[model samples]
Target: MSHPRNTLRTSTFSCTWCRVSVPVATADGGQRNHCPACLHSRHVLDQVTGGPSTCLGAMSPIAIAVPRAGDWTVVHRCVRCDELACDAVREDDNQLVVMRMAVRPLAQPPFPLEAFGTL
Candidate 1:
């Protein structure tokens, strides 16, 4: 019941923004602990949320993918680990926010719109 990272209190949990639960590290097996939706996580790991990050900065949504069960997952880049984790987005997640995050890349030109206009 105790993980080495007990000092590291990020016992993965569901994201309020997303309704899905992510699997947390458990003795029996991995439990869905993180929310699969919006993939936006609070700063609870630092012994404080909405405060300075011992890890430095809020978690960012870096990648998106479709995993088994025909479900979608969002990958979060941990500032501390520089590690990427694919978390399932819950169905109840803010659809607009999720869609905006999903479609955000397309709106931005890879090379920058200013660069294209100079041509």
Candidate 2:
């Protein structure tokens, strides 16, 4: 039996930072761009064109954004090219890593918390 040319194969990729092998498809049938173990991604797709990008840089998880719809997204910044991209959070993603990114800004606030007291 011959398979179709466009047959979907089990896609897996290695994490750029942690070197963990991860599957491209999540358990809930959603596409995953970041590694579940380290929450790191690679600069592979063009955010504007929705096509393959030539910048093969290591994308580090910078922040977590919760949309009005309430779904959390992991924002990544490329180390080499400085491109930014966001990907949906997977169910199996590491909670500690996600939480750390979410609270990073608050942990090291640019402005003093005492300023809020005056408000």
Best by lDDT: 2
Q: RMSD for each model, in Å, please?
A: 9.9, 3.5
State candidate 1's TM-score: 0.46
What is the per-residue lDDT of model 1 for residues 57-116, given as tens digits with 9 covering 90 to 100?
Answer: 345677667766777777677665464446666655557767777777778767766776
lDDT, candidate 2, at 55: 93
- lDDT digits (tens) for residues 1-119 of candidate 2: 12325356566788889989787768888888889999989999988899999999999988899988978999899999888998888899999988888888888788889889978
Alpha-carbon shift of residue 62 in model 2 (angstroms): 1.0
lDDT of each candidate versus the true structure: 0.58, 0.86
Segments of candidate 1 deviating more than 4 angstroms = 1-32, 35-38, 42-58, 67-69, 111-119
- Residue pairs clashing in model 2 are none
- Candidate 2 Cα lDDT to native: 0.86
**Sequence-dependent TM-score of model 2:** 0.83
**Best by the TM-score measure:** 2
lDDT of 1 at 98: 73
